[model samples]
Target: MPDECQPLHNINVGVLGHVDSGKTSLVAALSTKLSTAALDKHPQSKERGITLDLGFSSFTVPMPARLIAALPCRELQFTLVDCPGHASLIRTIIGGAQIIDMMLLVIDVTKGIQAQTAECLVVGEIATQHMVVVINKVDLLPAELRHKLVVKACKRLAQTFAATTFAGCPMVAVSAKPGGGDGPAPPAEGVPELIGELVKMVPAQPRLVRGPFLFSADHCFLVKGQGTVLTGTVLSGSAEVGGMVELPELRVVKKVKSMQVFRQPVSACRQGDRAGICVTQLDASTLERTLLCTPGSVPTFTSAIAAVEKVRFFSGTLPSKGRVHVSLGHCTLMAEVTYFGTPDGSGHEPAAALRLVLDRIGQLALNENVGEFDYSTDYAYQHELHGLEGRPSASGRQCQHYGPQWALLKFSQPVTAPKDALVIGSRFDTDVSKAACRLAFYGRLVALLRAEDPSELAHLRIFKLKMRAGSIDRVAPDGFSAVCKGMFKKDTDISLFAGMKVTTASGAVGTIEGSFGKSGKFKVAFPKGIVPAAPGHNSITLTFKRYIYDQNKRNMVQ
Candidate 1:
């Protein structure tokens, strides 16, 4: 059959469940390719009789001849990703979940829900909105008891996911393992029923053709003839043969030599389609799960400030100052959490605002003084006093610089993350005894702070002026000089001076910035100019940044 004539419906389905829950067995039954035999490819997995890594298999389920004539696609080709269920491999499961379109949650009918089963369900709920519950190994129970068990399992599932997005998903039962003492019994019960439920429940692939191309490579290897092959799903946009691609962090660009969708050669591939691409001018060894994007489409940043919400299953409160594992797509790294922002003034709420600073994990070398060059008027003389040999004749020499510290996090390496990206925060634990339930937190990247914008810090900063209400200040373009209403002793450190805020009787607000001089007078600068006030007549109030925890309100509920 020709390529166009063979209508293929490509969908990425992830098979997830607890250990020994027949996840691999279901994959084998569906594909008839014997995925368990491939488990021995890893010696440790073979010894333990468990899957230690992600297993891939594909199979085509033929559609009804009557339905095929009315649809654009003829067959459903599902690429099943069988993930490891061990507690130690939770990170691996997270990585797989990020790329899949829908999930097939397998559960052991005899055992119902186990420890890892609950963890995997939480992961799937966080990753995708579509899910199908598969209750496997029903052969262990009698036919009469099976219906009762199914009803009990459904109630338990509803209770577990009542607070989540996947509260009432569809459920089906099947026996993936071969039946005993049977000579080819006509396909154990619920086998065909499961397939029909899947066809009706699973949604069509999404089309993201306008935005820039974004692909996260989960696997990279060297093919015999092809130089480097990358296998992963397209997160957004589209890519075609001979198109230019770039790895923003690595700062390298390559050409797409060829493209394949589900092992079928194609001229182009769109969003939600699993693809394999062969690229030129790239060494296979240099690539390590890097994000591929169109040039100039993604922004690289060293630090960011965002808004985060904790997962419902996480029982404990997030630590103010500790390390947590942050996973964004396939990239997982350690991050520092800083609790910032004030709660509602109701005095009964806990802090809901937080800041996350990710640790750098790339290999890009940076200069020490990259962004340290001052752009002030006296920058030329200032650079000379520091024993600088060469200097640019111009004052603003386009060097990298860092701005004020207000809800800011700096990454040691360059990272590309757009606004509104889902950031999963998990407890960084290496102990095998601890369960996986303790490691699930979800947050959203709200905004990327730019160094050029100083006004961005205004909301997070607090100011308290030393001047009293009766002082009349002279305003100028450079700053305003005002006499201190309170007496200041000589030799007082300038650092003791606090920020100043003045509000006029007519309701005008302004902030003052500057240090105290030897004359006990202070000069303050305002971004929006100064508001005039009468001496000894205007009202002055001290301003400070309110801490969220100080409000004592409980805003977050588990």
Candidate 2:
């Protein structure tokens, strides 16, 4: 347990960049400890001289003497997470990104922005809003080249940031390696400046002491007598030495035997604290990047409905039917992407609307011939399922569906992530020849699909309403003129206009013919030259029949 008398404020900072960009070296310099040891500790990493997994270390910097005299605290503690930079290890990078409150984006002055560098920046923008760009290894360049490189790097970074959430972020130049020759080497210029900028940009960790305890475990191991240990950053609430924690996905509850922050024993730790927890009666082998939460506080589900946004850098259109890797919090799952709507006739590009159905957690496929994989009868699954009466079989395959602007994700294992959590989608390509610059998309898990019917489309309807385009303007006996609310493009196909079904609040129906006038109004033809009475407000609903998909039937139907 932590000593109550020597309390330290904890801040998590992630070191991220391209492989060989000196991310580990920067972390070691900042920590002044064997931070690189943590990286190379893994046997494979040591052999390859590259980080293959997430590595963690921490260091404390003394507060300025003046501030220390006036304030109660003497130092600030920073927990550093060094993320892997190889494109194959992108999932590991995302896992590290989720736990950190801020990021140190390392850019090698010699290499500028590489493929993985941009990907790391994109991950940073998705994972955190606070960051400091560190242009490292400036000591290798001449004074003139250093200045020119810094300016050029800043311009390129600016363009990348313009398309991301971290636009207008500040950048600083530094050299993480020790200066050659001479005593002390003047402390490696820019270290102090970078720290000062980080202090200014990163906000103090937010307190979630009152919320339910939520921890996303990134690493798990076992000790001889201490039992299973889980190490991760506390995302919300707090946990004490004797408190019980639940792994909702695994459906196991265990008592905390001990807890530590940065290797110092602690009685209790709060949100934003990176902790290593020793728990009683659990096997470490069963745990892999699982979510630990206060029992019943988290909403565990096999599916999630979300609103997705495309990545501007991806050249190819999103596939309507294909596999993807979905990263939410620290857990990554294999998923299938099902697009919802037909193209707007502008092009063959896949529709923005989508649904992601993930394979159940812990379930492995016995054969690929079936539509869905077979469920594993593991202890966790059996135990959790025993309580439910008449629950559907885990083996049954069901058709998944979504709507415009919203997506539905069905997982093989229940996820304990909270609503509004960010979900990232990446290509599931295993081809090593593909460039690392391939794009990734991200979205928010807005809600869970709780409908009893697996094929129900109620949520789809709500999503379509939010994506509604325009309404009717003039009604006539044989036809109606609808003033499009800027929803239709100038190049929109005449077939799309002619295929729309327009209905009024009073149940009047009309089929569009084509464009009516120079203005953006479409001419709609009614049946038998009879137009039903228009509602008092002239409000009408435009249903794009082309976009509607029947979930139960797994086909497009009007």
**Tens digit of lDDT per residue, candidate 2, span 1-558?**
224633666678889998988887777667743332265588998789899888888777765444443334556667888999988888888878667878999998888888788778777765666888898888888876878877887888777665445657888988877553324544566778888876665444334579789887887888887788888888888888889888877778888899877667888888778788888778888777888888877677667655454544444456544567788887788665543322231213232223332222111111111121111110000000001112123333231222123345666566677665667877757453565545456667655754445455332432122123455565563344433334455565555446667665556676767875655566666663434344455555664332233353322223
Off by over 4 Å in 2: 1-6, 32-37, 62-74, 143-152, 159-163, 178-188, 339-404, 412-416, 430-436, 450-452, 455-459, 462-558
Q: Which stretches of candidate 1 lie above 4 Å from their native place?
A: 1-6, 32-44, 62-71, 142-144, 179-189, 204-206, 340-413, 416-420, 430-432, 449-543, 546-558
Candidate 2: global Cα-lDDT? 0.63
The Cα RMSD of model 1 versus the native structure comes to 14.4
Per-residue lDDT of 250-283 in model 1, one digit per residue for the tens? 7788899897765678887766667778886578
What is each predicted model's overall lDDT from 0 to 1?
Answer: 0.59, 0.63
* lDDT against true structure, model 1: 0.59
Best by lDDT: 2
TM-score of each: 0.67, 0.69
RMSD, candidate 2, Å:
14.4
Cα shift from native, residue 490, model 2 (Å) = 36
